[model samples]
Target: MNAYSGHTYKFTKEDNTFSYIKVHIKTQIGVKNLTRQEAVKLAGEDPDYLVDDLFNAIENGNYPVWNVFVQVMSPEQAEKYKWNIFDMTKVWPHKDFPLRQIGRLTLNRNPQNYFTDIEQAAFSPSTMVPGWAPSADPMLQARMFSYPDAARYRLGVNYQQLPTNRASVPVYCPFERDGFMNFSDNYGADPNYVGSTLLPTTFKTTKQGRTFSTLTEHEKWAGEVSSFTTEIGHQDFEQAAGLWAVLGRDPGHQDRFIGNIADHLSSVTYPRLRVMVYELFSRVNKDLGARIQTATEALIA
Candidate 1:
């Protein structure tokens, strides 16, 4: 599967200056997708088809590779951009923000143990190396907290102590000790309290003034002050309309997309709700909404 960093992030330097970036990982072998009919057949016949294929590919030495690229947007550009940089639903057009090749990722090996390596794995967007930090994306901010909290609930409080979840570099947090499945020496008699004189702990040092960049006045004014609400407007459908135009360029792709959506919408029993769905899509494109409604109603009948 192709991987995308939907949430924008920051790449900071020792001077505390930063640039906003988003990552794209494209398969080196090129993208190949199964048709809806083939996908359905495989789902029923071999539920673990994808996992099996990936495992076998690596095991047989034909490792899957992905070319990694990053799209950078300066803080100044973000402030003046027409679209909100923090909106995960939107993307930076390649013409404006070109992709810069950063690196390659290769799935060279399989998991040694399913339980230890695969089952116990816990990942969070908040888990970042130095010089990397999160942006003001609302959904990303929520996920950063919720993901780790979920891991704590599902994998126990000391989930980070697990082999798969443990950081490669040293982490010095004595306060976070003696929880469920804590296998470490619990800091080995080190003082858990900060600014302890009895037992001193050395922390990894960074350059002075290398703090995460502060939000601009515009960002500060726009973020996190209102109660949550579900509302829709014409502006929201602008991106959807753009996507429809993109699909139109791909010949039968638009037809397949409509058919796929109709197959799912046909199962909706509520007549009013189905109408609402169609109306919402109508905001995207009139023709698209009409086609979907006709196809869905035909299937339901």
Candidate 2:
């Protein structure tokens, strides 16, 4: 199946020139889906079927691969886009910005040990490479902080020192030291803070274009500071209506979409909550909302 980062990020340069991007990883093998009945049966028979299949495939030399691509839009294009470019839920239409293949990702090996290789692993959006940077998306920002915080809570303060999470390249941070489980030399006797004339810290400056910790000058908004949160309006449902129309192209896809909603929604015990759901879907399409309500009521009755 294909995977998406589902959050807007930035492809940036040292000069502060950046383009908004959404990362996509398309599997070499086409996507396949089972109906709700089939999925429930499979879950009962073998809950770990998908993971087992992936591991077996890799062990048998059938390495799973995905083509990594990015949909890019210039800063100018973002301003003119129909939806807010920073909205995580809104997908940038492919017609406007097509996929550009960046690289290939392959899974060739299984973990040697579950505790060391799998359990200790940690990943965060903030741990980005030089050319790649984060955007102003609220969800992305939350993950950038929450993911690392969760890792630290689950693992330890020096969780990054673990073999699975450690950086291969040299990292120079003299201030971050003496934490629990710290395995390094603790920077020996280096100065914790750098402001002395006798000894100077060799820091990577802006001229080298390596200072990616914050947004560049052009990226910052020049207005008064205010917190941002997405507010729903009728316009918010337009893209959803478009998607419902697209589902009609495949004969049973629309039915499957309705069924998927009904199967889960029918389990809700609260009648008021169900009505609220129906009203939400009504914004997308009246027919869609009616169909979902009928199917759910049938299951409930």
Structure candidate 1, residue pairs in collision? none
Instruction: Please provide, for model 2 over 125-205, each residue's C-alpha lDDT reduced to its tens digit, 9 standing for 90 to 100.
Output: 989777687777778888999999999999999998999998898787766778899998988877776666757644533
* 59-113 per-residue lDDT for model 1 (tens digits): 9999999999999998789878877788877899888999999999999989999
- Could you give the C-alpha RMSD of every candidate to the true structure, in order shown? 3.0, 2.6
Model 2 poorest ten-residue lDDT run: 218-227
Candidates in order have lDDT scores of 0.84, 0.84
Root mean square deviation (Cα) for candidate 1: 3.0
lDDT of predicted model 2? 0.84
Runs with alpha carbons beyond 4 Å of true place in candidate 1? 196-231
